[model samples]
Target: MAESEEELKNLLMKVKEESAKYGLKRNIKKTKIMATGPITSWQIEGDEMEAVRDFTFLGSMITADGDSSHEIKRRLLLGRRAMTCLDSILRSRDVTLPTKVCIVKAMAFPVVMYGSESWTIKKADRRRIYAFELWCWRRLLRIPWTARRSNASILKEISPECSLEGQIVKLRLQYFGHLMRREDSLEKTLMLGKMEGTRRRGRQRTRWLDSVFWVTSMSLTKLREVVEDRGAWRALVHGVTKSRTRLTTIFTIFKEDMSHILSIYLSANAFQHSVVPVQLVTHKQGFRVTLIEQEHEWGGTSACMEEHGLGIWDAHQNAYAVHRNTAWRDRSLTSWMCSCMPTPLVPPASAMCTEDWCGSP
Candidate 1:
């Protein structure tokens, strides 16, 4: 956002430090910066003549992957490391700036499309393609100086013990992998269906189907901001509605799963060691459902008593009187799992139907 050379240098230095921590080195000679122009850019060196370029400083996409050597893999890993750093820095800002990194063209590692290629044939070499794509759209859209200031302020709000590097690594493994998995599954499924009548019948192969829900890696606060913001929320709802027909079948599948999940229990300690009862038995005979909390933090609201409990009316616990007494009750949970134990059963409003939350006794 800010075009200052010093600011850019400092940010790049931070990225370089992160790369070295990951046992990867950055080659600055391949690095280039376009401070002012039709398009701003940041380029960093890669292994075997590979280089990563952030198009217009909006995003960094991987390039130069023709070599199948270990060195090339190391460079790709560095590219990912750089991306993780950028994401953390961007999230620290209150106002997100959108960024897009386009990998110009390069050799792709066979590992990306693992298990799909036939072992009978020799691997192709030197194809011009983007190995990976990284989008930092939120960071690009923000005002630079404001973004930096907000980031600085956010550091004070967070714990010094909470390592940003650790966070980046976790986010990369958790969310980015999920996103890629979903995208790859969808692409493969479409391609597989079309291969029946296509010329490349031999290339047809099995791929996993996309799951119904993929958790957003963004923090709860960020998620709440996006989902609650009128503009962003409206757009999301509208888009979902437009795709409702395609998702209808998926929704039915989800409802089936929801009906099967009967109980929920969550607990956490000072060290954040947590336990969540995944599956809860229902009151009905032979019916048991699993509970999946979309929310990351499932601790109760009480600051003094950190321990919390939740249960649905199930065959095992329903007969117990202790399950019947609880401060909060979700009437809609009559059909599924709930926070309270057995209660005066009634169908509550759809929104009121408890899914997952934490609160005091």
Candidate 2:
């Protein structure tokens, strides 16, 4: 840590001297030191630079802790502003909701997702992202906060539906995949570069590469493999961001394993008393459940029922469940719904789950 500080100080001092030689002046008052590690304040020349917890550089906000939550929050606020700026058109009956949503996405989504490709996202960050998304959608739909409708109800009217997180993931994965393809480039080396040091107190925050694993559902070894074929990767990303049903299904299966879906399918098949076998298949979009419509002993010609679309968000008693029953079932037949709700922000765990969980920096 001391060595790191000396190196930084030497570089800054050299910069100051170089500025003097060029007849340029250094403003110590405006300049602030934002250290990442244990070394706090340091002297540039004779003036002592005070360490700051947060600072902005080239429009990107950075915290001493190196987490993106603060930046994400700021981006969301900017997105809200963008949405508000177009309030007249979005709320205007002169335009259709589809056009309004397109305008919002084209105009405001970029603001919301600025620099998201580099974010080391945490669950708190996800909650904030979804919260802002919900706010934007609610404004677009003119749904009051006091209304008792759920996300499922609101999703029905959303034309060309998509998700905030899913898009961010797609963008990030695409960016990473691009970089990974250019193995001989300096950017690739710098991006994949690592520094050796024992971490400070608590668990380490998720790095860009670590977060990409969750986004792509690939291990470290396979990251390069997935990026080899740019067309395939692009199609994969498109499938994720282009369809809201696929996005929801991704989140659904991401939360639970395919075994859970298999169990449900098995239970359904057994309950129907059908001799026909049921098969569970996984795809990029989601699970494909295929089963005989009826047993030959109980029916004539062979028939089949398959459920391939996204599931439905159903509320029974007091809890909620996403249903994926076959198309033959009327209630949840191939339904696609968003179960987005405000997830309670919890203190980050010391150990991060290798799957989808992330830690605060």
Candidate 1, 1-361: lDDT as tens digits? 3457467667877888899998987765665554334433443333122223232221223223212233333434554555555554445555322222221111122222222121111112111111222111223333343454432233233212222222222332333233333546653354235434546557632222211121132553454456445575444333322221100000001223455433232211012222354433233333333332112132333332233333322322221111222333555334443334333333223312233333312
lDDT of 2 by residue, 217-317 (tens): 57867777767888878866765454323112112222224465321211110111223332222332343323222221222112221221112222211
RMSDs, each prediction? 21.3, 13.7
TM-score, candidate 1, is 0.20
Task: Return the lDDT, model 2, position 54.
Answer: 91
Q: What is the number of backbone collisions in each predicted candidate, taken in the order shown? A: 20, 0
CA lDDT of 187 in candidate 1? 39
Off by over 4 Å in 2: 1-3, 184-204, 242-361
How far out, in Å, is residue 122 in model 2? 1.9
Give the Å shift of residue 131 in candidate 2: 2.0
